[model samples]
Every structure is written in C-alpha cells, then in structure tokens.
Target: MKATLPRWADLALIPAINLLLAFFFAGLVVLFIGEDPIRAVRILITGSLGSSYGIGFTLYYATTFVFTGLAVAIAFHASLFNIGGEGQAALGGIGVTLVCLTLDHTHWLLTLPLAILGAGLFGAAWAFVPGYLQAKRGSHVVITTIMFNFIASALVVYLLVNVLKVPGSMAPESRNFAAGAHLPFVHEMLAAVGIKVSRTPMNLTSLLALLAAFLTWALIWRTRLGYELRAFGFSEPAAVYAGIDPVRITIVVMLISGAMSGMMALNVVMGYQHRLVLDYVGGAGFVGIAVALMGRSHPVGVVLAAILFGILYQGGAELAFEMPSISREMIVVIQALVILFTGALENLTRVPVERMFARLGGGG
Candidate 1:
C-alpha cells in the first residue's frame, strides 16, 4: 500500500517541532543557570497570559513582527534574500514622519493613506537601488543589502540629530506627529461596549497586520505575478527557458518586500509612537528573518510565528524583571535555537545516522 498522510498532518508538524525545540533549548538555559526549569517556564507562560495588559503587549509586538515577517517572506517566495528590511523600514518611517510633521491637515481620512503611501514609496525606492545593482551589475544582493542597512542607519541618525531635530528639544527624536496620524486604539473603542482594559497598548494596527497577511496570501497563492515570482525562485534558468524575465521579477519582488517593510512603520508611527524617532523599527526587521523561517515562508505560518515571537519577547522581559538571575537576552538565545533546529530539520530527516537509531530501536 502506498503511504499517505493528510495535508493537515504535515502542516501541524512544523509548529509542534518548533515548540518542542524552543522548550528544550530554554530548559537547557535554565539548567545552566541552576534555576528550576519548570518554574522559569511557568513564569514565562503566566506572565504572557496572566493579565489583560500582558495580552495587549503581546499583540502590540506582534503588529511589528507580522509586517516585517511579510517583508522577509515575500522576498523568500521569490528566492531573493532581501536583507535590507532594516534600511527600508527606517526610510519608510522617515517618509511618514516628514509628511505628518509638514502636513497642515488634522483629518485622518486624508493623512493616513498618504502617510502609509509615502512610507511605501520610500521603502520601495530604497530596495529598488539594490535590485537594480544586482540585475545590471551582477553584484551580490546579500553584501549590498547589508551595506545599505549601515547606510540607512547613518542617514536616519543624521536626519534625526541634525536636520529634523526639533528646536529646543533635548532629545534625539522628532516632535509629536499631528493628531491625525495616530492609529485608533481598540481599548478606547471598547469602552463604548462596556469592556474596559486596564493599562493596555492594543490598537488597530494589529487588525491592519492581519489584513496585510491575508492580502499577501492571496497575492502569493492566487495571482499571476506571484506565480512568476515563485517559478523564478524555484529555478531561474528554468524560468528564463519558460520565457519568464528573471531580471524584472527580481526587481518587482524586491519592491514588494520593501513595501512590506514600509508598512512596518504603521506599528510605530501610527500605532504606538505618535512621531517618528531614531531606532523606531527596534530591530523588528532582523527579527523578521526568524519569523519567516519559523513560518516556512507561508503567510498563515508567518502570522502564527510572529505571534509566538511576540509572546516570547513580552514574556521574557517579564521573566527578567521578576527573576534576578534570568536575563531578557535569553529570548535571543531561544530564537537562535529555533532557527538552527528548523534550518537543520530537512537534512536531519534524510541522514543515515537517523536510520541507524531507528534500526537499533526496532531490533529490540
């Protein structure tokens, strides 16, 4: 009989494996520090779900992760590793901040789309530079994109510290954005329904992030452009033989990735901070790579993965505060372990070493 498995089985296995690895790695860290692993684990779980504020914080972090995760996933689908998400997101934040500070209108109806669009355009432009270089000059995108991240950081610092620095302000940030640029808080709206949340950060940006994921899923799985991009990703030579233009697809994919990064500004600019500031993206761009990998570059998986990261981030901070021995950096260790295990999963399943272990067990 031919062996078969349900599609859902395969889908469910990834998360199961990831969670197992995460716990095992975290447990090891706890052991090394001479702390009770179970207690640490319990603290992490309760801190994240024990209160309304904790849940709100989790979702708030998820908003940034989901947006940047989509950026990474989009590039992965096209077989292009666009590592310039940091720079792209920074530029996007700058774009929106400029518009928010300069625009005289206080109506969100006019400012919201414009702010998002400006950020998207800035991010697309930032990414297009590398795409053009890769397509025309045969430059390696990985190296160029990494360099661009440094350049973007320097550019933003200069703009914030020198050019856009608000007069008489002793900070390295911009002035508060116009009221119209702020995202609506869900908690405030919930008051009308008699559902009160104490000390929450939840906002409408989470809803936008979900909508972005759905749109990205439809684009990748149900559209012609997505088909061509995936075809190119699988095999560039084959794509060319099939009359697909690899160069154009490469540029287009980078633009889409950059645009997604640009949307990340919504989490900070519109969702939390009413103004753009230095380090607004807060390393979310780099974390997005882990999210994309954990999700296997699928849209739905990306959302789930983003949520997991968000939980770890918020929970780990709480753990650090409550336990004198534990450090918030443990979250980074956990993330690194997840990436290593997931990266090796495919190869581990095919290795002959595994077969020997299986044979030894079966002989018993």
Candidate 2:
C-alpha cells in the first residue's frame, strides 16, 4: 500500500516517536543498573531546568549546538555532509584569536564585529578548498573534510605550543584575551537590566546563535538563492537543466555552511574560555549531525533539538554526580543510544508508522 504523512507529521511526529523509544530503552538501561529510572528522569529535569544556574549552563550548551546544527543543516540542503565542522570551528577560533590579538587594545564595539568577520571569513576559506575539490576535482567532500579535522587539530596544537603560548606558562594555550575582547556573561547582561541570573558560562553569544537561526531560516526558505540550492540538492541534473551552475551552488553552500559552523567558536573561545585553547570544539561538531537529523534540518526544529541536547548534557552531568553508580561511561552509553535511535535506527520507527498510516488509509 502507498503510505504518506503530512509534512508536519513527518517532521515532528516521527522524530517524537523515535525519541520516546530512545528514552524508553534508556530507562531500561537505568533499570538494569539497579537505579530507579523514574528518579533518574526527575533528577535530569530538575538538574537542567530547575534553577537559574542549571538553565544558564543548559542555554550555554544549546547556543553552541545551534550554530553547529545549523551548519550541518545548511550543507544538507545542498546535498553535502560537511563533517568538518570541528575543524572549521577551530579555524574560526584562529580567526577570532588573530583579530583579538591585533585589536585587543581597542573598545569591544570595535573588536567584536571584526572578530566575527574574521571567524566567518576563516571558516568560509577553510571550507572553500574542499568545496572546490568536490566541484572541480571530483573529490569526495566527506573524506577531505574528515582529513581536515585532524590537520586542523595538529595545526592548532603547533600554534599554541610554539607561537601563542604564554611566557613561562606550562599550558599549551594562548594568553587570556584582553578585557576589551571578553564577552559579557549572561548574568551580567541580565543584571544590567535589573534582573538577575546565576553565574554561568552562558553569555551574549547566545543572542548571536538565535540570530543565526533566524537568518538561516530566511536564507533557506525566503530567498531565490535558497531555492536554487534546494533545487540543486533535489536533483543536480534538474538544476542544470534549469540553468543553475552546479559548481557555483556547491561552493556557495559550503561557504555558508562553514561560516555558520565557525560562529560556534565565538561562544566557546571569545565568550567563555577567553583564550585560545586546545580541544575547544569538544565534539559539538559531531553531535550536530544528530541534531540536524532529528530536527529535520529546519531552523526552529534545530533550536528545539539543540535545547534537548543541552538538557541531556547538563542533566547527564548532574546524574553522574548525584548517582555515582552512573559513571561517565554509562552516560556516554545513554547518549549513544539516543544518537543510535535518532540517526542510524531512525527508519526502525518510521517504517512502522508508515505501515500504520497505510492500514488506516486502506480501511477508510
């Protein structure tokens, strides 16, 4: 029987069902560990959303995920899997570092925009080579981007150890950025308006993340270029028949994807760490693929998915601390299960739903 679903059902309901199954299995894991799964759920919620401090950290993480998720989504629309978000984000940090080091003595108003431009430009440049190879040289983007991540890691390590390391410091990291380059913490920003939030790594960069999401929606759904990109994604031959240049579209989409991925560095490096540090990307890039999948590559869906992951991260930390039996390794298992069900096993639930819908339609 032919089976179909409304767009909203496909986007929202299928993912929701998959998520529930993931959590149910997660609860089973908790049960096997001799812990009350219900209590664990309670702790998870209370730990992530129960207090201002909790909420602050959650939002902080969600902010970064928003950038990386949107990055993946942008490329997915163009039929590209830009897995080098880690490297692109790291290069973006290099851009931020360069601008901050050169313009540190200036006012924040002067430094912030330049740093953003640097981050975006560096990120776009990093992706351009791969995009060009894919378009012009017939090189596979996946392999090249993955290789770039390792290269980026080695390059950053060399820079930190040999060039940017602070004098007499044992750590392999750059000096703390200047006060002018420091981003205001979310609590501080809130306090300025006579409201108060708990101290956390959350910062003004979250605003940038939100703005990126809105702009991504606009660029994807409300513009002619977006239509061309989607058309190219749907069928390159059809796009070519309609007079769109495949090479140009491919390169442009990757550039935009890289820039969005690079923006994640603004929060991690400039807003929180206040310095160039090793491993700053912290696997947020890889997590973004799952986010984009679960979100159906839509901006609003991406935001919600990001926030869900924020809950998982913050709540998982709390679970690890409160229930010592639930080690970090177990937390990783829980996260892996979520990723598995949502990504690799997504069709497991989808086929059943489709069959159910078919049966319903046939009966009618």
Candidate 3:
C-alpha cells in the first residue's frame, strides 16, 4: 500500500522528529560520559551560532556540504547511487588548479567561468565512463564508480608528485594561487559595503551554492527531462514502455551528478585553500550521502540538512575544546547517531506517524 503523507509532514515533520530522536540518544551518550547533556546542547548551539566568528566558520563548512549534498540528492532522484563524489571533486581541484595557474593573472571574473567549465567537463567525463559501462556493458554503477574513486586518488597523487608540485617543496601541493585568484572573503565583501563581519574562510562560493540549489530544484520539478528521469527511476521497464531511453537517462543523470560534485572544489580549493592540496575534500563527499538521505532527496531539504551538519562540525569542535572530557570521538559518535537515525532508521518514525494519520482519516 502506498503510504500517503501530507507534503509538509513528509518533507519537514518526519525529518524533524528523526533529528530530535537522534539528539535524544546522543544526550544519553553524553550523560554516560559524565557530562550534562543540556549544557552540551547549549554549547553546541552557541559554538556554531553564538557569534559572528562561529557563524562564519559554520557557513563556510555548510557551503561545501550544500554542493555535495545536492550532488548526491540529484543522483538519488534518478535512483542512482553516485558514490564517486570524492574522486569527482578531487579531479575538479585539478581542474581549478590548472585554470588558476594559467588564467589567474587575467582577473577573477575571466577565470571563474572557464574554471567552472573545466571542473564540470572533467567531472562529467569521469562520471560518463561509469554510466557508459552501466548502460552498455551491464557493469554495476556502484562498483565502477567506487573503483573510479580509488583511481582518481591515485591520479591526483601522481600529478602532485610528478607534475604540479612546486620545485624543491616537500609538501605534496602546488604553490599558492596568484592574488587575483584569491576569492574575497565574506567579511571583506561585507566591509566593502560598510558593514563589518568577522573574517573567515566563507567566501563568494556560498552564493553559488544557493544558486545551484535553485537550479537543481527547477531542473528536477519543472523540466520534461526531469519527468523522464523520475519515470526511469520509478521503473525501468515502465520508462522504456513509455518511450524513454534508459541509456540516455542513466548517462545524463550521472553527468549532472558528477558536475555538481566536481563544483565542490570551487569552495575548498579555489575559495579557501587557494591551491591544490592532498585530501582537501575532507570526506565531504561521503557526508553528502547522509545529507541526501536526511533531506529526502530534495534541494531545500538538502540545504537545511547541510546547515545542520555544519553546526555539528563547528559546534562539535567547541564542545571538545570547552569541555575536554566530551572528546572528539564522542562528538563523532553523536554525528554517527544522527546519520544512523536519518538514513538507516528513517522508517522507525515514519511508519508510526503514517499509521496515526491513517487511523485519523487524514490521509489518502
């Protein structure tokens, strides 16, 4: 039977309830560790949102999650699990680095658009191989993409070691990008307009993240291709019966997903790092899978989920610092609980609420 739920309930209430449940269990863990859960919650809130300083870092982290979350969310809508965001994003950093080295002296305005194209093309090409194998050779996308991730890591390492590394530098990284390539910080932009804010890594890429979310929403809900994609996702046989080309849908979805994942480099490498570096993605791609699950594969939900995680990252740091007993591993466990409930155990809350609504004659 189809479980009928109101739009608001499915999109908002269920996730909220799941989040609370996660925190409730996390609180118990804190108590077990001999800390007051309430105080910990307060510290969590304050550390991420209490001051401009904290907020800056929080938003900086959120910006990357927004991109990776959207990447995973798009693939989810098409019933494709694109687990290679890590590799795609790494390749994107290579794209950005090459572009910055060659065109940074020209001006940021000129460099950004070309960099976007390069990142998108590289990422899409990487994804296209897996999609082709899935559509033509019957190779499973999950295995192929996962394999490609390891390959991408090796490729990047080799490039840094042999090709892009600065002369005589022991670090496995390139030299700093030129001044023109430096992205203006949020504080600097605000200060230009006479409003002061705390300095942070947060930069113009945050705006691009929002724009990408909007574009994703429009593409998924308002386009004919979206209909075909959803139909394909719902049932491959049905889609083929309806004259949708399965191969085309599969390849296109992966391409779009890979492009979004690749764009994450814009924030980390271009905006914050200012040069290529090893392991710069910092597992945001994996975090995106959790974000996509919690968000129900919707763009707006992805944004909110991204922010929630940003809080966990920024606030978790402060929690460990202010109350050293809590420890970093405890914070990670708390985060794991959130992911566990939101992704794996979502139906735990969903089924009960659905039954309640059914009994009340409030749903179809």
Candidate 4:
C-alpha cells in the first residue's frame, strides 16, 4: 500500500520541518564566518518585524510575491513549467505604463481598472506564443519560457531607450505619472484613521494581492475547471482519456498564469514607482518559483511563503548593514539553501516523515 499523510501534515508540517533545516544550515554558515549565528538571527527578526517601517516594507515586498507565486501555482496545476514570469511581468509593466500615460488626467478609480486590464491582456499575450508552441509543436514550455525572459528584457530595454524615454530626460525611464494615477500609500490610509504607520510602498495593491490569493484558492479547489487542471497535472493521458482537450487546457492555463504574473506590475510600477524604469522587476519573477515550490502550489501556502521571503529580504538587508562581515551575497546563499531544502531536497525529509506516520497508525 502507498504511504500517505493527512492534508494538513503534508502541506504544513513537511514544509515547516524543511524550512527549519534550511535555517539551521544557514546559521552554521554564519558560524563558519566567525559571526554569532544567534545574534544574526536576532538582528534579522528585529529588523524585519520590530518596527512599523519594517513591517510595511515587508508587506510591500510580499504583495509582489503573492502575484508572482499565484502565477507559478496556476501553471503548475496544469503540469506547465512557466519560467517566463519575468518576461510576462516586464511586458505587464509596459501595459501599465501605456494605460497610465494615456489616462494621466483621469480619476484613479477609472485608470486603475484599465491599467489592470491592460497588464493582464499584455501578460496573457506574451505567454500565448509559448503555450501554443508547447501544445501544438511539442516544444518544451520550460525552454521556451526561459528564452522568452531574455527576449522580454531585450524588448523592454529597446522600448525604454528608443521609444518611451521622456523628452529631455537622461535616464532610461518615462515621465512621472500624474497624481491621479498614484495608488494611495498605506501610511496615508492608516493616518486617516488615527493609526500611524511609517511611510512605505504598502498600498491598495497589497489588499488586491490578498484578494487574489482568496480568488486563486477558490478557482483552484472549488471549480470544475480546477479539477480538470489538476487532473491534467496528475496525468495528461488520464485527462485525455476523460475527454479533456490538452491543447485548449494548456492555452487557458498559460493565459491565466501570464495574467497573474503581469498583475505584479500594478504594485511595483503603478502603486510604488509611479513611472516605468528599466529592469523594475528585480528578480521577483524567479523568486515566485521558489515561493510556489515551498508553498506546494497552494494559494494560502503561497502567501505564507511569500511573507517568509519578505522577512528574509527585509532582515537580510539588516544583516548586511549591521554586520559588514556578512556580505549581501551571504543573504543570497541563505535563500538558496532554503530553496534547496524545501524544493529539491524535500523528499529527503518527507519520506522519513511518511514512514514515521505510517508506523503511528497514520495512513500515507
């Protein structure tokens, strides 16, 4: 008989244990560098969660990750490896830029939805070609998507430098967006209610991210289409045998994934930066892959995983600043260890856990 675990244990306990192992090894690395690992951890927690400023920044970063994580998770449900989130997000920025620039004089309520629609459509368009290639030509989605990321970077650079650069501006960026296009900062919102928060990028987009997570959860687990997608992921042959069209499903899945990836632009570009700049994505696209893996492609898990990474980001900055001995590269190393443990090495801990549970009257 195949070993199994209860849903909660499989989803929560396993990932938690793996995460602890990652952090334990990360602490050892700090010790190897002659630094007190405990102090480093203390600094990390204090830096990320000790102040309202830190919490605001952490949530801002988490908001972006939520969108990208959902993008990855949606594709994963259909057994599609969408490595093109970077490209899709970049293109989404372009879409947002176009919408904001055109509606610079309009009310934010009108501009925001239009910008969102543009971003989603543009992102979906970017992913459609790769989806087509995969479904029709037998091309590998992973390879195609990765290649598209490079193409996206190049395309954005070209557009910014040659077509979209603001007149008389030296930098490769557009003109500042109009006030009507601005998303209200979280600090301002809180202040309106007599609650003080540090000025940070957290905004309405953060709420949108939360809403997206809930909607994703509903779409994935409570819908018939979600069932089909999951069935396809489990076995394409089985899906086909049940009369589901693989080509159609592949296309639909990629479109949805691309739209989610593109939506990240709203938080970073429209909500925070208020202008289009080169390379604004800053690797959040790839980070979403790690988030999805750690979260097991579930929306709730993705949000929690994204928050953890946000803590790492905010805390890592503190670690680098406070202890010059621990370089920023060390932070990357720590993140990699987390990814390695939770993703590629997950089965190492999971198998043993499953066995232990099996012996304890738990079915696996």
Candidate 5:
C-alpha cells in the first residue's frame, strides 16, 4: 500500500508548518521578555484586522511586495539571483519622478503610462549591466548586483538631498508629484457610490502588480523564450548543446526581471509617496528574495506569500502600539523564522528526536 498527498495539501503544509514554527519561536521570545505570548498573538491578529485603515495599509504594502516578489521569482525560475532589485527599483523611481517633473502634462492619462514606461526602461538598463557582465565576462552576478545595490542607494541619497532637492523644503525627498500623476485609491472611488470606508493608500498600482504576476506566469509557461530560459537554468551546457543561446537568454531574462522590479516604484511614486524619496523601496527588494523562497518560485505562491508579509508588516506596526513591550521589529524575526523553516524543512526530519519518533511511528 502507498500513501499519497494531493498537490494542494503539500502546498498548504508549507505555510501551516511555517506558522507553527513561527508561533513556537515567538513564544520563546515572549517568555524571555516576560510577556504573555497568547496575548501578544491576539493583539497582532486583532489589531491588523480591526479596522479599515489596517486593511488599507496592508494592501498598500502588499502592492510593492507583489511586484518585487514576482521580479525575484522570475529571475529564480531562470536560475538567476537578482540581488539588485533594490537598486533597479530605486533607479526606476528616479526615472519616473524625473519624467513627471519635467513633462508638465495636464492629463494623467498621458503622464502615467510614460512614467511607468520610463521607469521600466531604467530598471531594465540597470539590470542589463550585471547581466552583460555575467554573460560576457563570467563574473558572479551575486557580487556585482550587491555592489550595484550600494551604488544605487548612495546615488539616490545624493540626488534627493542635493541635486533634486525641492525649492524650499529641507527634507530628503523630491518635490511632490503633480496632482494629475497621483493615483487615487479604490476606496475613494467606491465612496462615490455611497460605500464609506477609510481612505487607505490602496490604488491602481495594486491592479498593475497583479497583472505583472499573471504576465510572469504566462511568460514562464507559455512562451518559447521562457522554455529556453528554463533550459538554461537547469543546465547551461545542456541548453547550449540544444542550440539555445545562454548569453542572450540571460540578458533578456534579467532585463524582464528588472523591469518587473522597477514597477515596485509605482506604489511609492503614484500610490503612496507621490514622489521619489530616500529608502522608498523600504528594503522590499531584499525581502522579495524571502518571498520567492517561501513561494517556491511559483507565481501564485509568490502573490500569496507577498500578501502574508504585507499583513505582518502592517500588523506588526500596529502591534507595537498596542503592546509596548513587543517592538515592531518582531515582524523581522517572524520573517526570518519562516525563511529558516522553509529552507531547512528537510533537515528537521533528520533531527535525532524527530527521526526516533518517525521510526517509532513508522512515518519516515
């Protein structure tokens, strides 16, 4: 006789297991801090879902995570680790800001698409540099992309503080975007229909984020180029023998991944901040790697995982306010634990106690 689990069951198990482990770890932290873990958990849950404002914030944050997670997932499918999503996103934001600032258009219909296109192009260009280096010179993308991240951060800081500084403000951010360029929240539009809700930052960018995820799924599963990219990922030499050009695939895949990453800025520029700012990406690109890992590089999984993180991010901040002893940074610990459990799930079965139990139960 054989025992089998459905594919959806396996998928469900990952998050269930991850949450169980997270709770266990969070309990330990609560004990160390002399607080009630159950109370803390209750606060986190209730606070995050208690009001319209919380839900709005969660969706707003989710918008960025979805975009960046898809970007990382795309690169992961192609066997590329795009650590420079932070840089690419920042550069894209800068491009969009510059375009909006200079275009001086009265119509949002014209400016919005141009800004998005400009941002995507900027991100693609930034990613292509590392892709070119990796394909042509055999340089390690990990090192080059990390360096690019630092450069991008520094460059954005300089540009915002000095070069693009607004006329009268002392803040480290660009001038507010033109009113026409700002994205209106869905809640506001719905309010016009007599449905009242808290005006959260959720916007059209969220729709774009979902569209990008769908496009990524289609690109990976339905396209000839995607087939070649996956082949190169599995084995470059094998792909070469099959007449696939690894260099071209690498560059194209990276460019596409980077363009997706660049879209992350849509939330900040058009939806939230309405302009570029220092640390606008909010370390989202780095967190995107964890999202990809949690999602196992699947498009739908990435979207789900990104939403989970978004919930934690918005909820954790609220939790800090409700429970003074527990800092908002606790979310980071939860995220790290999720990553650890997913990465080492197989190793957990090898633990001596677990192995002994498995043997006794005939479950191994």
Candidate 6:
C-alpha cells in the first residue's frame, strides 16, 4: 500500500507544523502567567544562539542528545523499544572513567579511542542482558530496559560510594581525569585555528556526534544488516519467512543502540564534567525517545530535533534566570509541553494534514 503522504511531508512538513503548534500553546501558557510570550521567545533565541558562549553550550547539549537520539532511532528500526538508554549511558560513563583513569598518563589523542571502545563495550554489555532476556525468555524489552535504568543507577552509586570515589571525598563521584585525559574545549580548538570564541563546556565531541550521525544514516539505509533489521521491523512474519533470525537481530540491534547511548557519556565525562558524577545522564536518555519520535526516526531528523531541544534547554535556563518571574519549574513545564505535543499528541495534526493531502491527490 502507498503512504498517504509524501516522504517530504511526512519527514519535514508535519514536524514543522507540530513544532509551531507546540510553540503557540506554550505562548498561551506564558500569557496566562502575565508574561509577554513574544518577549520570552526573544530571550530564548538570544540566550541559545545570540552569543558564541550560548551557541557553544547549545551545541554541547545537542551533541549528547544526538547520541541518545540515534540510539533510540536504531532500536526503532528493529521493532525494538529499548528504553535502557539511561542505564546504558550510565554504564558508558563508568567505562569512560575506567579508561581515562587507567590511561591517565596518556595523551587525550591516544586516550580517546580507548575511551570510546570502553564506553561502547560497557554499554553493549549492559544492554545485552535485557536483549538476551527478551530474545530467549520472552521477557518484554520495555519492562526489562526500564527496570535496568534503576539497576544501573544503583550500581553506579555503589561503585562511586565504595570503589571509585576518591578517599576523603564526600561526593559520590570519581576523581577528576588527569590533564592528559582532558578533551580540549571547543573554544580552544577554534583558537588554535586563529578564531577567537567564548569558552563553554562544548568540546570536540560535537564533531564525533556529527560523524556518528552520518555513520548511523549509512548503517540504517545502506547496509545488509540494516535491511534485515528494517525488514523484521516492518513485518516479522515476512522477515522470518525470508530467513532472518529474530533472536540475532534483536540482540544486535540492542547492542548497537546501547553503544550509541553509552557514547553520549563521552560528551559529559570527557568533554564537560571530567569526572563521573551522579545523575550525569540528566534525563537525556528519556529526552532521546522524544527526539526520535519528533525526528521521525531518521538520523538527520534526530540531529535537527536534538538541536531544537538543545535550544529549549540552554534557552530555558536563561529565560528563568533573566525573567525571574518565569521560574525554573515553569521552564520545565514549557519543555514538557513541547514533548507532549511532539510525542504524545503527534497525531493531533496528522489526521488533518493527511486529509488535505489526500484531497490533493496524495493517494497512490
């Protein structure tokens, strides 16, 4: 059967409209609170993009989202809803910390590859358990993955408190990475090329995120494994008849997804925090689910959506700080509205758009 809407409309137009609707309603909320929505928007824009400093922070946040967003999108391609990104990312942080600590004397140029490998391995291993259960024991992936998030948290806490934490420290976090283990900041990299920019937490990891996005696109659309995964996602019975193994596909997809999620830790552990911190994932894992939904499960869409969210996050913080009247909680409510419109209420505009397109010869 032909799709009711064209690919362009499905991928771009619908999301654009949904975003506009989300902003419109969010404006209404601002009005109800006796604030000028237009002014609020201007502040958000200025905060997130107006200055080099703000832009740096925005890109940094977007980099983390890119990894998690791709993770969710990959799982979606295999008919899997792997919600263990929070846990996977957490474990990935552990992997990064372990590697960085182990190679404290090495140059960052040398440590990076090892850190990536460690993060991927730990995340993949963490995800393997849930995937194995789902494939071999009929355990639902959603339940297992979600449950693993808490388990991951507990495990990290235990490690930090007992094994990883520096002696005489009160915080439940590992010691800072050595000088050589520190990834260069984005501004430092730019300055090296003679371009002066404001400093922020953003770093070279953003480049890696973009490269990963490209790789994800290639994996999903150009590879045999991707074809098999998509075939299974589209129709399991047909894929099985075509000789695809559900167990293997399920496990492989989960591993890939988990690795992607785990790699997000690089942005925080290596680039920003330089240490293992509690709740470091900061719900980016959950946000990735919304990002994948908004992006229509495409790598490009995920990057774009992740940036949009990056704007909300960095901009929202500025909004609360400057406005004072809006408050941080209000900013969260605004962000929640975006998620609600983009994810839960996504179909609200779809039916009408489909009707219009159908009337205009959308039928194949």
Off by over 4 Å in 6: 1-3
On residues 112-162, what C-alpha lDDT tens digit does candidate 4 reach at each position?
999999999999999999999999999999999999999999999999999
Root mean square deviation (Cα) for candidate 6:
1.4
Model 4 regions lying over 4 Å from their true place: none
lDDT of 2 by residue, 1-364 (tens): 7587767778888889988888899899999989999998898899999999999999999999999999999999989999999999999999999888888877678888998999999888889889999999999999999998899899999999999999899999999888888888989988999998789999989999999999999999999999999999999999999999999999999999998888888899889998999999999988888889889999999999999999999988999899988887887777788789888998898788888888888323
For 120-206, candidate 3 gives per-residue lDDT tens digits of 878888888998899889898889999999999999999999999999999999889997677788999999999888888999999
lDDT of 6 by residue, 93-210 (tens): 9999999999978899999999999999999999999999998999999999999999999999999999999999999999999987899998998899999999999998999999
- Where's the lowest-lDDT run of ten residues in candidate 3? 355-364
Clashes of each: 0, 0, 0, 2, 0, 0
Q: What is the TM-score of each candidate against the true structure?
A: 0.92, 0.97, 0.97, 0.98, 0.91, 0.98
Question: Of the candidates numbered 3 and 4, which has the greater TM-score value?
Answer: 4
Candidate 1: TM-score? 0.92
- Screening candidate 1 with a backbone cut-off below 3 angstroms (N, C-alpha, C), the clashing residue pairs are none
lDDT of the candidates, in the order given? 0.82, 0.90, 0.90, 0.93, 0.81, 0.92
Greater-TM-score candidate between 2 and 4 = 4
lDDT, residue 267, candidate 5? 83
**N/CA/C clash count, model 2:** 0
lDDT of 1: 0.82
Q: Please list the residue runs of candidate 2 whose C-alpha ends up more than 4 Å from where it truly belongs after superposition.
A: 362-364
**lDDT tens digits, residues 198-313, model 5?**
88888888888888888888999899988998888899899999999988998998899888888888788867788778888989998788788778788888888888888888
Rank order by TM-score, top first?
4, 6, 3, 2, 1, 5
Residue 359 lDDT, candidate 1, scale 0-100: 57
